[model samples]
Target: MTAHVAESTITVELDGQVRVVRRTTDVPVRNVKANKPREVSDVV
Candidate 1:
């Protein structure tokens, strides 16, 4: 059996077992802004 999940995910079942599959694609980034200095709170 197979089922459609959220947009990029899917579920499949066979022989009493189930598996989940997810599709992902790398998105090209353009003109990214420079990183800003993090505050002390930003550190764990």
Candidate 2:
């Protein structure tokens, strides 16, 4: 049996077995301010 439950997730059969597939995506960086001060807490 085969089923597509969502846009990024799916279920299918391969090689006489059942499997679930999922999609992944990259995330953008945060707090990207130009000419920002380098605080002491950011010196990790």
In model 2, which range of ten residues has the least summed lDDT? Answer: 25-34
lDDT of 1 by residue, 1-44 (tens): 54545566657678878888875744443434647998676556
Best by lDDT: 1
Q: Which pairs of residues clash in candidate 2, taking residues 3 or more apart in a chain or in different chains?
A: none
User: TM-score of each candidate?
Assistant: 0.38, 0.29
* Per-prediction backbone clash count: 0, 0
As for candidate 1, its clashing pairs are none
Looking at candidate 1, what is the lDDT of residue 19? 86
